[model samples]
Target: MDKNKRILSFLISFFMVISFIVPINAEKDEKNIFKEILKDDFEKNSSIQEIDSAEQKIYMVGVEGESILELLDQGYDEEKANKIALDIQNKAIESIKSFKNVKIGEKYLYTTNGFSITTDRNTAKKISLLPLISSISEAQVYEKRVNNVRNILEIASIKKEYGLDGAGMVVAVLDSGVDHTHKDMNIDSDNVKLTEEIVNGLKSKNKITYGKYFSSKIPFAYNYADDSSNVVRDTLKERADFSHGTHVAGIIGANTKDGGVTGIAPNAQILNMKIFSNNPKVPGASEDKIVKAIDDAVKLGADL
Candidate 1:
């Protein structure tokens, strides 16, 4: 009977060991498969060329978290949803900061739960192993496509039919820069206006800095490319679209009472989120900058 008891104990221990090994091996296999898929995706999307492993390039890194829409569907308000995403991004960034060959740049939460990083291909593959990271993709460049809004979309008829003047709405325009000082943009309406002190301050200074010139027409403004609040056009020599942002803003919210060029939604307030660098060599807006602008737009309460 003692011998039978000893045999039973040995059988129990053997089974327990087998169970542990199976699970660990399965988990490892799953991770390996995931990493392989990531590698395929990285190469396919990025069109990566054979180069030194040490060379770095900009890549968009997605984080593991609930998206803004998902959070809202789960009953969180817009602000709370954004905050949660921001927290997830921040935590993930902190966890991976010490990793070699990775440098975090602008972080996004609202529109996209991710951050931009400057890292080489090898480090990016390693980064995919982290539980905090969900995806990695090469950044793409985008150019502005000028549109004839009124003729193409027939916005007047739609506005007339729907009686939509965009009152009580905030519109965010992501472009090079908005000439906020344009007479068409300064129309008086029910939207919030710039404070007297701010106007005086802008007028008194020889140069305007960040966050000082926001008027009632253009409430919130930021230049994501330059990392400044000055959204005014610096020069006209850069591109023909130097006044692109201002022109777009005019189309959306120009409410000149004296028969000036009127926009489709003259009542809507404008939020300036400039993404273009205006550099002749690097003419188009980078994906990272555009993502950052959208993230900021959501945080700043853009209705459109």
Candidate 2:
């Protein structure tokens, strides 16, 4: 009887130890998985502070590195770390209240605190933020009146009379790639064979002259200080960094035979010289690339 009792007690103690160890190990594994996923998402030593506003969530970035890691180490999850970051950001914003002598990075600090200001970092000029303030009440759309202009039927009638139903014109779009497969924009017919293909270095056995691909969505130009050669490329095979050039191309040369809207220059051939992307936050296209594209366009005998 004594031996049986001792064995039972040892079994109970062993089960308790196993139970505690399982959860701890599981939690550790979970943390490791989360860390792996988040490691690539965060900027190097950078933190983001989310500010809750009535209108939109404002995020302040580029917080000091050590402070962010320290918060993470304190058992504060990512959310708590972000909140503390915002607190620090709000403090920095409050420090620039008077705005006597503004430095380069110090200009827009007060916008978080409900003040507007503009600064030219290169020239070191300060401008009144008052003009920057706008309201929906002050907005108005202008409608232009053309003499003897009627409805769509009248335009169609005129087009028919002039025999200008857009028969033999090609427009080249060089913007973000067109949504060729869009329900309203797709071109289908035996005579009008529209092809979508990527323009990178590889060649496929079944070659269709034109098609869509991921690389064509990149921007035509960027203005950052990084070397243009590292980011920009001549062939469409190179990934498009921005979608702006594609969008522009769509506007100027999307196939109109498919009952889509006509472009400003509908008859022109679209030679997409993708040079800039959708949002050109950077300055502009590289000068050499721009010049080369222009020279190629001119050599192609483009009317423009």
The number of the candidate with the highest lDDT is: 1
Clashes of each: 3, 42
After superposition of all CA atoms, the RMSD between model 2 and the true structure is: 27.9
Off by over 4 Å in 2: 1-161, 165-167, 174-243, 256-260, 264-268, 277-281
Cα lDDT tens digits, model 2, 37-88, are 3345534322321122122211112222223335666787756664665566
Error of 2 at 100 (Å): 46
> For each candidate, C-alpha RMSD in Å?
19.4, 27.9
Q: What is the lDDT of residue 266 in candidate 2?
A: 33
Model 1 bad stretches (over 4 Å)? 1-49, 76-87, 150-153, 191-213
Writing each residue's lDDT as its tens digit, candidate 1 over 1-304 gives 2443233233323322322111111222232433666656855744333445567877788889987767888999877886787789888898888886788887776566888899887777667778898877666666665654434145455555555565556667777778777777754555443344543453344122344336777776777777776566555564356677677667667788688656666776777778776555765677788887766555555565
Per-candidate TM equals 0.72, 0.27
